[model samples]
Target chain A: AQTVTQSQPEMSVQEAETVTLSCTYDTSESDYYLFWYKQPPSRQMILVIRQEAYKQQNATENRFSVNFQKAAKSFSLKISDSQLGDAAMYFCAYRSPLRDDKIIFGKGTRLHILP
Target chain B: GAGVSQSPSNKVTEKGKDVELRCDPISGHTALYWYRQRLGQGLEFLIYFQGNSAPDKSGLPSDRFSAERTGESVSTLTIQRTQQEDSAVYLCASSSSQGSANSPLHFGNGTRLTVT
Candidate 1:
């Protein structure tokens, strides 16, 4: 069984500043994928970024990027130049690289961007 | 539909009653999944169907909850004799990853199920 943990329940960032949401997971498999999803007030789950365990080079999607440390079993999301619209509930998810692919999501972190 | 669309955007049902939630996955998508999100909680995996085969049904909380997909298209999640604990948003997702397992899931807005 794979378990994803997001230690921070809530975090706040000033406008134009950066925020990093931390996530860790426990999995015995050697190959897997990590992801960050955002859910806004509308309650639509949107994919933020993704990182494959085999890729040491972190994944970056404009303002959203991930710091994936496979050895440490940690995958963190960094949002740069945060804006008010960036405020949402962020979730870290884990997916197996095998045939039966299932995604496991963490408890989630509520991010608040202050103007 | 253009994206994964779930019907009955909001369902208010009494405890012990049965409810059926529907999901229409995107065209050409071979994978469909059901997830539950309780208030103030993360998404919980319920069931998964890939190209007419459901290889994983382990995430379902209890036997009362079951789901089915036909011909790799529409899916329905049925909860029999629903309980208060079953109140939550039922989310449906679709992906193109059939057996190879690399595509990411695209989620719908979700059906909010309120069991009182």
Candidate 2:
């Protein structure tokens, strides 16, 4: 079975600063996909970024980027010049077509932006 | 409509009662997913359907939970003899294709189910 883990239950960062959220997963397949999702108070999940296992380069979208270390099975999210809107619950997810059947998600990390 | 739609934005039911939640995926999306989120928690994948492939119910917590999708359109999740623990936000999402590129998921606002 494939499972994702987000060690940090909650995180705080000052506005205009940078913060990194850690994520690790256990999967036997080599070809897969990873994603980071942001869930606001509205309970709407917005995709932040995604990385493919076959690609060595990490994925970046605007202020959000991922540090994907396939060997370590670690995929972390980095937010640069964070804003108040970035404060939300972030979830890490894993998916594969050849291995597991459904997308697996971590417990999620609640991000708090401090002024 | 333009995005994934989940009906009955909020549903409150008594324990041991059966409840049904509906999901309408994007018009041309080939994949649909159902997830359950408890308070302050992450998504718990419940079921997945892709085109004409057999649905994956491995993530379902128990036999009491079941879901069905007609082709690539609407889907409904049914919980029989629901328990208090079943109270949570049920989210539905869909994607045209499950890939790493620009194919990201489109999610619905979710249905808040409260079993009292």
Candidate 3:
């Protein structure tokens, strides 16, 4: 079984500043996919960024990026130049490389942005 | 993308009653999934369907919870004898394909279910 853990229950960042959300997972599978999802007040789950275990290079999507350390089993999300709209519940999820494998998610971290 | 859509945005039912939640996957999507999110928490995987094949129900908390998919299009999660603990937001998501390492899931607004 794979388990994802987000040590921080809540986080806050000043507008235009950067914030990093930590995430760690325990998985025996060598091949897998990692993802970060954001759920706003509207409650719609939106994809933030994703990382492939096999890729040594980190994944970056504009202001959003991931620091994936496969050996350490760590995948953390970094939000650069944070804005008020970035305030939401962020979750780290894992999906097995195997076909039909279900996605497992960690307890989310509530983000707050200060103006 | 059309994105995944769910019906009955909100549902309230009494204990011991059976409730069904619907999920409509995006056109041409081959994978659908059901998840449960308790208030102020992360998502809990409930079930996964690949086309018309057998679904993976490993995440269902109990036998009272079951789901079905029709021709890889619409899927429904049925919970029998609903309990107070069952009250949560039921989310639906779909992906272009399953068993792939790179596919990212697209989620719907979710159905808020309350069991009284």
The interface root-mean-square deviation of each model, in the order shown, is: 1.5, 2.6, 1.1
lDDT of 2 by residue, B1-116 (tens): 78889988999999999999999999988888889999988888888788645456778899999988887799999999999999999999988774523366789999999999
Write candidate 2's Cα lDDT for A1-115 as tens digits.
Answer: 8899999999999999999999999989888889999999988898899999999999999999999999999999999999999999999988886633477889999999999
Query: Model 2 chain B — which ten-residue stretch has the worst lDDT?
Result: B96-105
CAPRI-style grade of the A/B interface in model 3: high
Better structure of 1 and 3 per TM-score: 1
lDDT of each: 0.90, 0.89, 0.91
Q: Which pairs in model 3 have colliding backbones?
A: A99-B99
Residue-wise lDDT of candidate 1 within A26-89, one digit each (tens)?
9999988888999997888998988888889999999998888888999999999999999999
TM-score leaderboard ranking: 1, 3, 2
Q: Taking the tens digit of each residue's C-alpha lDDT, what string does model 3 give over A1-115? A: 8899999999999999999999999999998999999999999999999999999999999999999999999999999999999999999999887755578899999999999
What RMSD does each model have against the real structure?
Answer: 1.4, 1.9, 1.5
True contacts kept of 2: 0.59
User: What TM-score quantifies how close candidate 3 is to the native fold?
Assistant: 0.95
Error of 1 at A109 (Å): 0.6
What TM-scores do the predictions have?
0.95, 0.93, 0.95
The Cα error of candidate 1 at residue B98, in Å, is: 6.5
True contacts kept of each: 0.57, 0.59, 0.85
Runs off by more than 4 Å, candidate 3: none
lDDT of 2 at B111: 97
